[model samples]
Target: MIPMPARIIAVCNQKGGVGKTTLVTGLAEVYTQMMGKKVLVIDADPQYNTTSALGLSGPEFTLNDVLYGDESNNQKIFPGVAADAVLEVGEDWQSPNHSELGLIASERNLASRERDSMMAREHRLRIALKGVAEEYDIVLIDCPPSLGLLTVNALTAATHALLVSEPRVASVEGLAEIVTTIAEVQENLNEDIDIVGVVVNKVRKGRKDQDVWIEKIRTDFGELVLDPLLPDRELFAKAQAAAKPLKSFGSEAKVLRADLEQLARAIWKGSEA
Candidate 1:
């Protein structure tokens, strides 16, 4: 029997530094390790932070290569396990669980390839991902912090989107931009695409202002906002610096691990809804 096709989810927000990469990387780890689902991570950002965080060196073939077929001779270049592979969510992998996370590693050259023909934009990522859809249960795309071609490609390819925002004034203001972009994409590009829900990240615990914004977002968006917020934790920064996921940060990561697990379940169930 054939495997079910993966659910492609784009973790997107127009604002930068809102923990988009962190959520994508960590969720991918949890989905695979805890839930036993195979996962693929697409680093659509040219910065390749997700690529490096996952311990993959700059690969010759990025989404650009697959988009333009520029490196047609190197289409098979998937992420390979590196020595520094970090996250340890399961007993199966003693080293970092890089192998468990399928990454289409990016490089600096990806920036130049963004200028490809407009017609090529719609199906670039979808076409590339089609070949590997059977390998994983889910594909989480780490979109760039802008609504450019890279983001357009992600939106077009995804079945749904996970919007990440912080409990900040600026991040709240940026939510409108994200909603507008998603609307435009659904109208003009991919009709099947939907906003899965908004994820509130980096939330400050017991902050009055944070509570106010959270309620405002929920009231405005209704059920589009998910429950169980990701708190602002120093461990998140430490995990980034250590090149590991929150789940691998040892005992300090327990609460975070539980939260992410709940988040994963929400994602799975939301997809069904």
Candidate 2:
């Protein structure tokens, strides 16, 4: 019997430093370690922060190969070589209790793809992942902090999108750009693409500005804003800097772990529905 296709989700934000890559890895870790689900992370961002945070280094084949293909050899192209580029960060490898995690790594060369003179580039990502994405229960794409070709490809490929933002004026303002981009993608690209919700990330305590913005977002977007907001904790950065999951921190990471698990569960429930 063949496996069902993964629910591809793009974790997107048009504003830089909104923790979009962090959320992508957090959700992937939750789905894998906490829920025992097979997960794949596509590092669509040219920065390749997700690939680095997951403790993968010097990946021979990256998302660049998948997107542009091995044109030098005339051997592989879109949809055919996607599987060839995937690498596994296995259980108990970087962090404890981790299940096998699939990764289509990214490199700085991917930034060039944005300027490539190619037709139908927006659909290339979707075409590449066609059969390869089915091996996992979920595929999370870490989109760049811009509404450029790479992001367009990610949105085009995703079945759903989770908008990430910090409760700041700039980040909040940038949400409209991404939301409008999603709307345009729905209108012109993938009609099936729907926004899962907005993730309020990096909320700091005692910041009245953060509070005001959170309230404003809730008023504006309603229930689309997910609850139990992610706090601006040093542990999140520490874990990423250490190139490990929160589980590696043991009890010290309990609170952030719970928050991530809760949001992951919400996403899981919605995806299943």
Query: Top lDDT: which candidate number?
Result: 2
Write the residue-wise lDDT of candidate 2 on 91-157 in tens digits. 4333345456888999999999898667677888898888888888899999999999999999999
Model 2 bad stretches (over 4 Å)? 72-76, 90-98
- Which stretch of 10 consecutive residues in model 2 shows the poorest summed lDDT? 90-99
> Which residue window of length 10 is worst by lDDT in model 1?
79-88
What is every candidate's alpha-carbon RMSD to the true fold?
4.7, 1.9
Q: How far is 102's C-alpha from truth in model 2 (Å)? A: 0.7
Top candidate when judged by TM-score against the true structure: 2
Off by over 4 Å in 1: 71-99
| Distance from true location, Cα of 90 in model 1, Å | 14
Cα deviation at 86, candidate 1, in Å, is 18
Against the unseen true structure, what C-alpha lDDT does each candidate score? 0.76, 0.86
TM-score of every model versus the real structure? 0.86, 0.94
